[model samples]
Target chain A: MTDSLQRKRVVITGLSVVSPLGNNIADLIQQVFGGVSGIKLLDAPFVDQLDCKIAAQAQFNPADHFSKHTYSMLDRASQMALYTSIEAIKNAGLILDDAVKPRMGIYLGTGMGGANSLEEGYVRLYRDGASRLKPFTVLMSMNNAAASAIALEHQITGPNQTFSTACSSSAVAIGEAARLIRHGYADVMLAGGTEALLTYGSIKAWEALRTLAEEDVDDLGASCKPFSANRTGLVLGEGAAMLLLESFEHAEARGATIYAEIVGYGTANDSNHITQPSVNGQASTMQAALADAGLSPNDIQYINAHGTGTQLNDITETNAVKKVFNGHAYKLSMSSTKSMHGHLMGAAGALETIITTLAVNTNMLPPTINLIRPDTECDLDYVPNVSKTLPNLEYAMSNSFAFGGTGATLILKKVK
Target chain B: MTDHSVSSDKVLDIDEISKVLAQMIASKMELDIDTIKADSNLKELGLDSLDTFDLIFNAEDYFKIKVPNDQININTLQDVTALVHRLIVAQKQ
Candidate 1:
């Protein structure tokens, strides 16, 4: 409320995660630290049909565990999405006590929105007829369905949108939401991503793209081998993650538990290719985010990488990290959460943000699971296969690179 | 059971309808002239789910028929032709 042009300060007050490794935040932190792997073999109909059967599907179905809403309008993906959003709002100390609900906003991201639901609808249509399709099919299948569902569920009348930039979707969503709160668009915001494309059609689409691990279909214990020489393809995953953001003053006034402050966010596109990643864009995006936070590269102690375990991504990201961090790259602790949780695509950024946030909150860094051998080019300290406790650090950065050469980076600092 | 074709005064012709349906999709999607076949699968012809929906939405506008969601999954170009033809005849009746 002080300046009309300058954005206000933003801080994270609430957090929730539903990943392949775990359902709740506590379980996720434990499994991630314990070197537990979530990637597994698939027996579903589509897996059997695909050349690749490996995926990091959620260990437990949210519907089986969480309460089912009466609307039933949401596809399963949006269901987990809204569930995490509500949980974050409640946990964030913003409990809609009349005054808080009116000032809040929600934003979500997804690489593929309701793909499973649309696929199912198509199957029914092909087998049956026009009358067989569900009444809510179109509404549930929109790319913004997750955000829309959360808005309806929480009754959020504030700004609502969905980010869909392939993999960097959630990172951009989180950054934009932070910007909104900081710019006084709202006092608080709920931001993150949800993606559940674990279906035959989606897997087939991946297979067609030739970005899937064809041979490892039966290996239930396999994890994404980021920066590994043998890394050939990325693993698909499903889940949702949400964070509750509020202005620092607003949070302090409300006596909320502040986890960390979102200091900077940067986004850039390579304009090079539709699917391939560019090292220059990655470097510039990281630099831009650090600059936005008004911190030097030396300020970042940990980096949660956009390590998809694909050969191209690993090598490309390694070059970018080395260039950006210089010699200090080797000194910085960096790891890929995809190693254990698999690639949640759009949700990866949101989930990785939470992972970095938790690291700051708990003062412990999770391990890079299944890295038996380091890739020759990627020599950065990956904190291989074992978690380590660390001293409190002021700044950490998370990187997200999506298809279409879109890149996003977020830098966060402890709130003191 | 009934020789409706002979007595069909308000019915749409299936063959003519198929030709027009093919042209509509091929024109809108900018089909690879050589690839577009009357019997070829619509998906194989590069008509993705979104494109298919777009075709249906346009058809709904032109025919003034509320196309149901379940019937939108027409697999082949022939399937689309048959659907349009049947729906037209039904609407006329």
Candidate 2:
């Protein structure tokens, strides 16, 4: 768009995560690749009263990572985002010297920011009848808090933005960040999503919607059964994942290790309904991404689905894939890592994108765990509770379809 | 919250109040208690204006004394302690 300069290519140079599955890249890869489940019994005080007592909670201690005063000032969401961003910078071996600092930016996504702090403040006000609250309550509770915290910590002074599209928040965030690099708005970007909404009030609200999975009678961790006939609903989860993205030329000039090239990104919304996903919306978005990547339906070897383990989502997404890929839909491998990690809400897309990137780079397919009895309507490979190696895997797509009918698709190509 | 007695009836001398103030400042700033000299400027010790407000709030809760916004013109740990002590004495009277 600017001066018809050759469209730049965006590539992922580094990745970091703090999720229910694992905290670092190695552990995450091991867990996902081994088809290990991260879903566990809820560890909150109010779990006993709630019907849905399972969640995928990230195991993190802020005191171990942040200075006492610094951690006190941040919400849980900001803490995860800041930690992952720093780790991603180090992973990329990036030097934030003067020349690069000004051109760098931060883009983040979150469904709910500072849920803990907001809930605590409300409890103090209404329950305890306290007149005063914490000084940083507003700063921590704002939706842009995580992005601002990341920007402040790294002194990234360009194009800081935050996107909130419910569950698809991070996917949209990563997609827009790549667009920024591709269009020459910024040379480098830290893009990702974070969510920490596992509070009593948040869960009770979600439970009221009747869209949460009931705990399995036998195995508590097997509650979230995506694409299964007996699936109840989604299991709420919390975590954060950040990726260091740089223009191809910028990364190459620095001799950075490229994980994958972000060839295409597509985002669309269904104007028909707010909560129910539209097959037309998902199909069109995937088609748009393929066209942008200059690839055909047959070219995509894998899809990281936005399968939320709900009755509506799994069936709708299956139909959407069939509509887009047709017969090739049967050929391509598809899986929902949410089956194991639960639904990370905002961070799902970022984490799944990273997983897709790894699949392209390493030629391995992550599996959809806990799918005991696949629904006939949702018929697909789904990788089926077992990870497998796929030789010559070159291109993979990650999908995130959120509430409010927002759908995002990202196409990643192997660096080779 | 600071671990001081809740009731205003609990009396403390200037030295005890100063010790308590120094401990609170050190904990809030994540500094070593021994390094928190009474003569050191709080700003120089990395406690910003917002941090001062937070410290006052904690003191109010711990010492059971109200700190008026205008009455706070503290620079050193000693000033904070003397102010809190005076507020406690006023509350008692």
What does fnat come to for each candidate? 0.00, 0.60
Question: Residue B24 error for model 2, in Å?
Answer: 1.3
A142: Cα error in model 1, Å: 0.9
**Candidate No. with top TM-score:** 2
lDDT agreement with native, every candidate: 0.81, 0.90
**List of chain B TM-scores, one per candidate:** 0.74, 0.88
What does TM-score give for chain A of every model? Answer: 0.95, 0.98
* Candidate 2 residue lDDT tens string, B1-93: 437475546778888877787788888788888888778889998999878888887888778788887998988888898899898888888
What does the i-RMS of model 2 come to?
A: 1.0
User: Model 1, range A1-416, lDDT digits (tens) per residue?
Assistant: 44646878899999988788787888888888888888888658655677777788775565464443223457778877877887798788676755766778888889988887798789878866653455567888999988887877778888888889989999999999998888888888999998988898787888888876444444555646787766777888999999999999999998999999999999999887888888998998898898888888888999989988888888888899999999889888988888888889879999999999988878888877768777888888888889887786778889999888889999988877
Off by over 4 Å in 2: A1-5
Q: Which clashing pairs does model 1 show?
A: A8-A182, A130-B71
In Å, residue B4's CA in model 1 sits off its true spot by 30
- DockQ (model 1, Cα): 0.02
